[model samples]
Every structure is written in structure tokens, then in C-alpha cells.
Target: MIEVKDVWKKYKIYQDKPVSFKERFLYKRKGVFQEKWVLQGISLSIEKGKMIGLIGRNGSGKSTLLKMMTKILQPDKGELKIIGRVSSLLELGAGFHMDFTGRENIFMNASLFGLSRKEINSKLQEIIRFAELDTFIDNPVRTYSSGMFMRLAFSIAIHVEPDILLIDEILAVGDNAFQKKCISKIEEFKEKGKTIVFVSHDNGIMERLCDELYWIHESKLVKKGKPEEVIRDYLDFLSGSEEQRLKNEVMQQENQQTSQIEVTEQNEEVNKKENKRWGNGAVEITNIAIRNPDNENKFIFTREQRLEVELTYKTTNLKVERPVFGVGIFKMDGTNCYGTNTYIDKVELEISEHGKVRYCIESLNLVQGDYYVDVACHHEDGTPYDYITKAANFSVHSKENDQGIAFLPHKWFFEKGGES
Candidate 1:
């Protein structure tokens, strides 16, 4: 179990760096600086056997709170208590010594976790095997790749079997297989009634693993409840409807001048063409378009309107069997709203030469915001044939004042009760 109350953290941001001792002395009194509070009166409690997930925007003090929980950082003013042994995986290669060999670092890290030499020896082989680093165990860790480093670090962390496990986003570094292995280990820990606090942007994984969710915004605790409810609220904030309105107002003012108007349009076109693209070239996506009910390609739509995504591609080979076509809708701030693939939907396609595929939605159901679409064609084995990031940009406007990315089909009902 872990408990925190009235936690506050603050840091000073320096405006300038002195280049020399003389400059430092001269500017000591005049240097500009500002105080930034990363956390303010934050309070939460995690029960002994429950898994909790943390969600927040980048730089919103999620990591700061995690560090405080792990005792790496002290709260400026608060009471904190933890009732168990703790293990933390905060950053990539955080606890390992760069100069030490992978073999040596395992022992060092385990020792820091409060294990004796005999205990380390008993679990040493299991850790190495889980990491799959037998070939490079004796090599200095500096020579290892990011995936190798994460594997070793994660392996050692779990083998220690602490009462509390705190994980950040470090799992993203490893490959798909290793990530699955790590998840399985976490599930095992949960069965053993260990407390886990995880921070991740992958909503699907969090919803599956966590018993509850905490939503943090701008260093304040926004909500704490079920995963679906908290995640929905977080996504709404990331959609940035108010922020986008301000931007549109600024653009309208600039459009009063013909010269400035043309420059803005040119920049928009450049941005559209600059979307990131990568693939093995087995198949290439030529174009992507968003269409409305009238089948007219457009970049904007209304909420609850019929929407379509069209993908145009070409296959290099004579016949490409079972090509997976996928689309992802993401808020401009990098929150994934929804994603789907033809394979997952039980649709099959075999393309030869050139082809066009379209996905139709009965109702867009998206709230008012700017969003980007990602399109990809890949093999069944997850090898990308052609993957495009932010391939198309679009905006959704709504007459209804909804608070989330999607509109659910629901109705409100009330019941009256009388004393018997």
C-alpha cells in the first residue's frame, strides 16, 4: 500500500547559463529565473492488492509523482508512506552502470534492491535467461542496444519480487515479443496480490491491466475512477477544442491581408506533404482522402455525419496475399482516439497492380477538434509494406456540446422513490 497527501514539488527554471566564472559572478544577482510548480497538493492512495494506472499529458508531473513514490524525489510539502519493498523502472538504463558488464550490473542492481549475494546467485540464471543475453552477458552494457538494455533492466527488476512495482513507459523500448513476456510477468505478479502502478499512453493495455485509473491534468488530480471513465476524460482534454478555436481566430485575422493569407495556405500544403512515410516498398500508398456522405473528399466534417477513409495504393509484386490495411485516428496532441484494421474486422484483400480501399463509418461521433489519420499496408506478420503517419488531416465540428472524443448511444432516465 502507498499513501500520499498534500504533495507539492517546485523547481526553478534558469533563463541563462553563465559561460565563465567572471560572468557567473557578475550575473549572480541579475540573472533571470522563474519558479515552476510541477505538482500541487496532490493526494492519492493505492490499496495493497489493486493495480492503478496513471494518465496525463507530457510534462504534466506524471513522472514527478512517480519519482516521489519511488523515493527518488522528495515532496516539497506533504506526507508520504509506503508499506512494502519497492522496485521501479522509471527510465531507460536508469540504474545500470555504463562501464560495468551486463553480468556484473545484474548483481549490482539486485544488491541495491536489498538482496544478498547468495540470493542473487540463486536467481542469476533465471534473470539472464529471461533477458536472452547469454551471448553478451560479459560485454560492457555500453555496447548493448536499447532493446538489450531494457531487457536486462526489466529482467532484474521483476526477479527481485518486490511488494510494489512501479513502471513508466520503458516497456516501449523492447520488441513485440519481449513486451509480451513482460506483460505476462506482470499478470503473474497481479495474481500474487502485489501492488502495481503503471504509466502508459496505450489505452487498450491500461484498460486491460489496471483495476482503476487516475487522470492528472496540469499537475492536479483531475479524476480517479474506472479506466473507461478516466480515459475518456483525458482524451477530451487532448482534443484541444478550445486551443484550436484560438488558432482559427488568429488565422482569420491574418487572412485579412492577401499576402499573409497566401503564405498560410502554402504552409498548410507543405505540412500536409511532410507527413512521415516509411515501409519496405513491397506496397506503396499513393494517396489518402477523407470523404463525406456526398462522396466528396474534404478535410472537415460535422459530428455524427457519415465519414469515409479512402486509401490508394500499388503493389510491387504480381499478387500480394492478405495485405492488411489499417487506419488510426489521433488527436493533434498524440492521443490515439481509435484504430482498426481490415484483418481485425474479418475482411480479406488480395491486391495486384493497383487498388483503392475505403472504410465507411455510419457516424463520425467525434467531438470538436483537429485530428490526423494514419494509414498503413502490412503483411500478416506485422512487417510494414507501406506505413504513413499523419497521412491526412481533418477537423470535426459539432452542434452538440459533448465532452469526449466519441458520442455514445445512450439515454437518461430517473426513478422516484417513496417511503414505505
Candidate 2:
């Protein structure tokens, strides 16, 4: 159980970081720094035996609050209390020594959780087996792969038998098998009525796992309620933000380009600076257009509607050979729904200075949600000529109340509950 009342936390942003003593002395007096309040008057209660989630945009203070619950941080204002043996997946390698062997660090890390040496010895083999570092348990952690280190850390933390677990996106550890194993372990813990505070951007996982959800926004608690209700509000807010962002990705140029390719205007240099797009201007994605089969430009469509993506590109390279055109669709949460390239399809290309390429999806089959498109122009050897990411955004709506990323095309063959 936990209680947070009017808790506030702030961080200082220094304009200049001095490297030497003289520079430090010179800048200390001027002190051109600003205080950014990461959390302001946040109050929430985590009831025992409930799995709660904290959802927010990055840097909205979800992790900060989790750390506060673990007592790794103390709020600058207000009262916070927790009554339980706490375990956290935050900063997985914080207490780990690079030079120590994995088996040795297990004892050290577990002891930090107030476990006696004898108690740790009992869980030692279980931790090593779960980490799958059987033969390498005695190897120095510094020599382990990143995934191996994360596996060791996660295995140790979860084995501490804490009454309350505060996890911050550590489920994405190791290979797919390990990740599934970790999720199963967490579910097992849930079955035993252990309190859990989980934070992740994977809406699918959060919806399935959390009993309650809290939305943290702009250093404040925006909403907290059932996972379905709060996540709907959160997704709606994200869609609106994406709408504003799409305006920048979709721009109008002269009608001639629209007639020829229906492309959106872009400043490649600006996009490069923002890391949204980057490539040599030898070949460029002049613009992009998403429309229905009727050639009507639209951003919202149903799962059954045909989605057509047309890309207009120009190449200054007189003989750009073996060109590959690619398009990818991504969920709002950064999950890749689908992607393909002409190279994979073995499509040969012969282009003049400018031309158009179009890819069509007969049925998007995506359940109601916002998705983004990425377009790229590259050589056969994978040298990018023009690679634009999140170049376009669109939404799919459905009458069916099914959850998940996509709607599987199928049918129910039930003959009055009789066997075939």
C-alpha cells in the first residue's frame, strides 16, 4: 500500500556544464540555470493487492514517481508513505558492479534488499536458472551481453520476494522466450495477490495486465480509473496530438504536383535536423498522398476500405540504378503493423527525373486506431537516397468492439454449437 499527497519534485537545468575548475568557478557565479518542476502536487493511492499502471508521455514524471515510491528519491514537498517490502526494476544495473561475477552480484544485490546471506543462497540457483546464465554465472558481468546483464538483474530483483513490485518497462529484456517467461512470472505474482505498479507504453500489455490505470500529464495527475476508461481518454488525447503533428507532415504545394503525384511538401533539411528524415538529396520524396480507391484524399477510413499510398519522388542522379521503394505502417505506440519494399517483391525500376510510385492495401484490417506511414527511397545495396519516417498519418475505425492491433479476416463456422 502507498499514499502520495501533494508530492512535488523538480530538476535543475544548467545552461553550461563546466569541464574544468576555472570554468566551473567562472560559471558558478553567473549560474544561468533554470528549475524545471517535473512533478507538481501529484497525489494518488496504490491499494494493496491491485496492479496499477502509470501512463504518460516520456518525461511526464512516471518514472520519477515510481522511484519516489521505492524511496530512491524523496519529494521536495508533501507527504508520501509506503508499507511493504519493495522491489523495483528501475535502473536495473544500478547496484551491479561491472567487475563482479554474476553469481557474486546476485548475493550482493539481494543483500541490498535486506536479505541475509543464507536467504540469498536459497534463491541463488533459482535466480541463475531463471537468468539462463547457467554456465556463465561465474563470469564477470562486464563480459556479458547487454541482454544477459538485464536478465541477471531482473531475475535477482524479482526473486527478492517483495510485497510490492514497482516495474518500469523492464519486460522487454532478452530474447522473445525470455520476455514471455518474464511475463508469465509476473502473472504468477499477480495470482498470488502481490501489489504491482507497472509503467509501459505498450497499451496492449497494460490493458491486459493492469487492474487500474493512472494518466500522468504535464507534471500532474490527469486521470485515474479503470484501465479501459483511462486508456481511451489517453489514446484520444494522443490522436489529437497526432492530428496536430500530421498537419506538419501533410502540406500543400502547387496544384501541378498534386495532379502529378499528390505529394506533400517537405523541407528535407529541417526533417533531417529533427531526425524524422535523412538522406542525400540525390533522390527525394517530394510529397506523399493517401487516398481511397475513388482518389479521394482522406485520413480516416474503415477497416474494409482500400488504403492507397502514392509517393512522388525526384532523382537528380542521372543513372540511379537498382532503386528500391518502401512503405511501412506503424501504430501510434511505435509498433510496426506492416512494411514492405519493392526490392523484396523483385520489382525493377526505370525512372526519369521525376515519377510516382503507388502501393495499395486492399483492406487495412486495422482496428480503430491511429497509424503512421514511412516512405523510403534507397539503392539495392541499402544506401538511402531519401528516407522519410512517419511521413504520413492516418486512422482506421471499426464498428466491431474487438481489441488489439488488427482485425483478423475470418469467420465463425458454428452450426448451432454442433460438431462438424
Candidate 3:
């Protein structure tokens, strides 16, 4: 959680500032300095347990506001408050000691998170492997390239698992594959209810990852709302001349962002599983999440995209023998759109301990509408070990104007005056 009320920040650029008395006396001239406000009365509140994106152009005070969140820079005026252990990737040169080796820097950087020596020791290997610097772990930081430095830095920041994570366009320093891996890790963070604030120019990330977006313009809090809405307005501010040109370009890119991802409807964690959840004490469904086929976290999907459900569970019994997993998709109006189970698909599973199960639909030919899912872990005899009515709710959209509940593959034909 974070609160910045009427926060103001400024920087002084000194033209001819004299540091010593000797220079001042010899020059007999005063320093000419200019005061510039980087953030002006920037009041905003961020809730806990969701991802956030900060959007703006260069010198638009986006990074300045992010720095204030970490208390690295103080606001010249107004109130600033934050709660949680904070970790930041504000700039590449701020965290590591240039003379220290990569392995040594891991201990030093993570120590700042208030972790004990033993704690740091435990995560050292994981950090190095995630950064893919196993070969160069002992190399000095000064000898490393820019990508290697960022990989280590990003790896350390995430491993510490701070309640709040602040990233300021630092993910741009890696290869395409590594960048994708970094994004997937960030998605896992969001699902774990970590508060993340990212300053990025990647529209795809902003659209697909963030729950809310804040737009800063000219050192002021201009707008804050849903990601798609704010991103649309921010893009228009960029085009200036041909307003819709960039918007059309974004539209071609795809799903819930700017014009590209115009969500017709949305919901916020609507798990109405009160009386809907029931089962025996043998096994309990711990949690469930929705994602794209690429294993990326997602709530909004299109008719053409594949949907994957990740279900995690625990068992009181020594082992859940002959466990059958099932998924039932339904319309918001309580219409049972479809249902299926592992028993029907002839899949086998033996859950001896806590584990996760994955159910995938190669193609959901559903029309534009809001829908809910019911997940179950039961026996082959149609007995329910655990069943949730409204486990997760999501919406589907399409570029075509289809009216039915399911998107049907059809073609139109016309015969005018037997012309054919």
C-alpha cells in the first residue's frame, strides 16, 4: 500500500556553483541555479494485492514518483507514506558495488532487504542460476556487461520477495528470451498478491499485466483508472498530429489494452464460492488461476485464444487415490455452457501430497459474454471430494459481432435472381 498526498519534488541544476570558500572569494560571483519541479502535487493512492503500471513520456515525472516510493528521494513538499518492505530496480548503477564480484554483490544487495546472513546464503544459488551467470558468478561487477548486470540485479530483487516491487524501465536491458522469462516471473509475482509498480513503455505489458494504471503528465497526476482507459488517453497524447494513427497500430497488436484490447466488461476477484464450495475432508482445492496457453497469467481472453486453468490443491489423506479433476464453464446467467473431467478424458493422477493440476481448452468457441468456472476434484463414481461453484470469473471478446453464447463457424450465402 502507498499514499502520496500533494507530493512535490524538485531538482536544482547549478550553472556555476562554487563549493569552496577559496573559489567563492576569488570569483566574487554568485551561482546561477534553476529550480525545476519533477513532481508537482502528485497525490495518488495505491491499494495492496495487485499490479500497477505507471505510464508517461520522457521527463514526465513517472520515474521521479517511483523513486519517491522507495524513499530514495524525498518530496520537497506534501505528504508521502508507504507500508511494506520495499525493493526497487530504479537504476542499474545504484545497487551494486563496482569492485565487488557478482557472487559477493548478491549477498551485499540482498542484505539491504533486512535478511540475515543465513537467509542470503540460502538464496544465493537460486539468484545466480536465475540470472544465468553461473559461469561468471565470481567475476567482478565492473567486468560484466550491461545485460549481465541487469540480470543479476533483477534476479536479486525478485528473490528477496519484498512486499512491494518497484521497477523503472529496467527490463529493457535483456535479450528477447530473457525478457520473456522476466515478464513471466513478474506475472507470478502479481498472482502472489505482491504490490508491483512498473515504469515502462511496453504497451503489451501494461495492458496484459497491470490491474490499474497511473498516467503522469508535466509533473502532475493527470489520470488514474483501468489500464485500458488510461493507456488509450495516454496514447492520444503521444500522437498529437494524427491522433488515431498510433491507436490503430495498437489495435492491430491485440487483447485488453488501448484500442487493441477494449474490454467490454470486467470483474475484480469475484469468487462467490460461499455456499457454492463443498466437498469432503479428504482433499481441498486451495486455489485456482487463469492464464493464456503460453502459461502467462491472464483474466481477459479472446475467442481465438486458448485458455488454461491452474488448480492447486492439498490433501488431508495420505494420498488422494484415483483423483479425478473436472472443469465446468458457465455463463454469468447460471447457464452450464460446458463440463468435462479427467475421467471422461481418461487421464490418470495420483496426488500423494500438495500439488497442482492443469486443465486446458485448445479452443473455446464462446461468444462475447461474462462467464464463470466451477472446478472439482472428485472420484470416478461421481462423488465430489471438493467442488467450487464460482471458482473464477472471466470474460471473452471477439472482433466479429457474434450474438449467440457460443461462437459458431458459419458462412453466409445469397442467391439473387438465380444469378449463380
Candidate 4:
């Protein structure tokens, strides 16, 4: 088991305006400087073989916590216990020497990871093959690319055969192929019951890989739960933060005591800027909005709510046949949530090359999250001519607060035979 008991880490920050020369001299000593707590009374435990994720925004003490786990940093007030052999990939090439050749550095680093020379010799070919650095193994470490360095570092970490693994965002550094390989290799370790703790900002991977997650907020452990639940809370917090920031800036500009005339002129200019548009030369999309059954602009809704998407488009050029309009919803990662087009229905009509058209999507089943709609106009022959990636963005605002690719309303029925 791994346990953290009210672990707190503190660092002394020198005052920028230390008054006297004597004060400056005392600032170097702990008693004079201001103490800031990075991790404040955090306590948690992990059963053996469980996979955990530590996540937060930048400067949320994620790095500090990971370093403490690896014994690179000590907590000021609390206990952290580890019962197994641990291998960490917190920083790439942390113990490597730039002046040494790659082979020499690998041997040195592997030995530091608790691997003997005999074991490293047995696994040398496998590690080099995974790293794809056989040709450069004889070259000095300074000559390797960042990708090469990451590959070698990851290869070394995995080859150590640790009972518990600590990984930071190092896997995110490599190419897509290497990243996939890392995911696969980590899954293999999970199958063998090796405990792993990961730190990353990639929510997709975190959701899939971690059984549980720790959320750090404002220098404290604010929440902990399944990955999906923590991510939902984090995203909601981010949305509120952005909204507050915008409100603060607007308030500051409005309250400035000087130049009332200039402020009025600035307001007018802003309105004009908002009204200006690069009207699509071929087609125009106007009045795109989403609504619930009552026909009000709403983001919150039940899965069964009558959802509708409405659009009005005008064409500038002649249309020999009914031009197809495509509407699609996309996830944050660019995957299409769902889409439909008139062309799929084989609708045909003759309209003037330049004319107006209205499209409405009524009662479509949708999952929850922040989704943006993409719109495109094309010919019946399937040639895209005009399109807009961000026609509008909206949140589904699910009531159930579930985590998934899609939420389906399902039920199970239990029955017993009636004396057949």
C-alpha cells in the first residue's frame, strides 16, 4: 500500500522589499523569509495494484507531490509511506550526463534504477529495439533529438520492472506512434498488477487509464473520485473562471474615472466590431441557435428534452439543384459527435443560383458536454463549396452528471416464467 498522511511541503520566499541590510542578511535564514505551503495537509492511500492519476492546473503542486513520492523532495509536516520498489520518470534524463555516450549513460541510469549489469545486459537489445536508437547508442547524449531522448528515457524507466511506477507527462513528448506504444505497454503492466501513478493534463487518456483521480485546487486536495467525475468538476470550474475574468475586465474598464467621452466612443466601436462579418460569398448562415422544448436559448436539459437546431442560409450563386447543407456536432478532440445532411435523404429541388434557404433540426438525441456545430453547403454531387467550422458552440448541460462518450437512457426488466 502507498499512504500519504497530512503531507505538507513548505518553501521560504524572500521578501522583495526587505527593509534593512540586516533584514536582507536574515532573509537567507528561514526565520526571516515568508513561508508558503505548496501542499496543505493532504492525506490519501492507495491499495496495491491500483492505478491513480494526479491532476491539476499549472502550479497546483502536482510536480511537488510527485517529487515527494519519489523522495526527491521532503514534506515539511507529515508522513508518506511506500512499501515497494519504485521507478520514476518524473523528469527525462534526470540522472543522465550530457558528456557521456548514450550507452554509458544508459548503463549508469539503469544501475541507478536498481537494475544490475547482468539484468541490463539481458534486456539491452529489447530496450534499444523499443527506443529505435541502436545506431546512435554509441553517440554522445548531446547529439540526440528531444524525441530520441524521450524514447530512451521511457525505455529505461519501463525496463526497470518496478513494483510501483511513477510517471509524469513524459509520454506526451514522443510522437503519436510512441505514445500509443507507451499506452499499450502501461496497459500490459496493469494486467500484471503493477501499481502506477500518472500525472497529465490529457483528460481523454486519464479518463480511460486511471481508476481514480486526485484533484488539486488552490494548493490543497479539493476533490477525489473516479476520473470522469473529477474532470467534469474541473471543466465546470474552468468555465466559471473564464466568465469571471471577462466580467472583471469589463467592470474595470467601466469604472475608470478618467475620460468618460472616450469610454462612450470605445463602447460604440466594440458594438460595430461585433456587427461586422465576413459574409460567405457563396452562402450565408444566419440566426443559428439551440433551444429546448419551450424554445428558449438553454444549455441545461434532460436527455429526453426536445432539442432543436435552427439555421437560415442565403445563397449568392445560382443553384441548378437543391444544394445540400450539412450540420455536425464535434467533441473537443475534433471527433464528430453526430451529423446529418439533406444529401443523405436524396432531397432534390430547383432554386435560383442565388436564394435563401432555412434549415431546422428538430428533436435530435444528443449526449452531454461542450459541443460545437459545423455547417457546410455542397452540391448534390458531393462537392463542398462553403463551410463554417464554428457555426455555434453550446453545452448539452446534462442533469445526471455522468461521464461517457455518450449517455443512453436504458432499463433492465426482470421476469420469471409463469409455469410453462
Write one digit per residue (lDDT tens) for candidate 3, span 38-121. Answer: 898888788888788999888989988988898888989999888999989989857799999998899899998888889999
Model 4 global lDDT (CA atoms, 0 to 1): 0.76
Residue 51 in candidate 4, Cα distance off native in Å:
0.5
What TM-score should be assigned to candidate 2?
0.69
RMSD of each: 13.8, 9.3, 24.7, 9.4
Candidate 3 lDDT at 248 equals: 51
Q: Return the clash pairs for model 1, or none.
A: none
- Please report, in order, the local distance difference test score of every candidate based on alpha carbons: 0.86, 0.86, 0.83, 0.76
**Model 3: C-alpha RMSD to truth?**
24.7
Q: Which residue pairs show collisions in model 3?
A: 255-261, 256-261, 257-261
Model 4, span 15-67: residue lDDT tens: 56567779668775534568888999998898888999998888888889989
Scored by lDDT, model 1 comes in at 0.86
Runs in model 1 deviating more than 4 A are: 17-23, 29-31, 241-392, 395-420
Q: For model 4, what is the error of residue 344's alpha carbon versus the real structure, in angstroms, after optimal superposition?
A: 20
Q: Per-prediction count of colliding residue pairs?
A: 0, 4, 3, 4
Better of 1 and 4 by lDDT: 1
What's the TM-score of every candidate structure? Answer: 0.65, 0.69, 0.57, 0.64
Candidate 2 or 3, higher lDDT? 2
Among the numbered candidates, top TM-score falls to 2
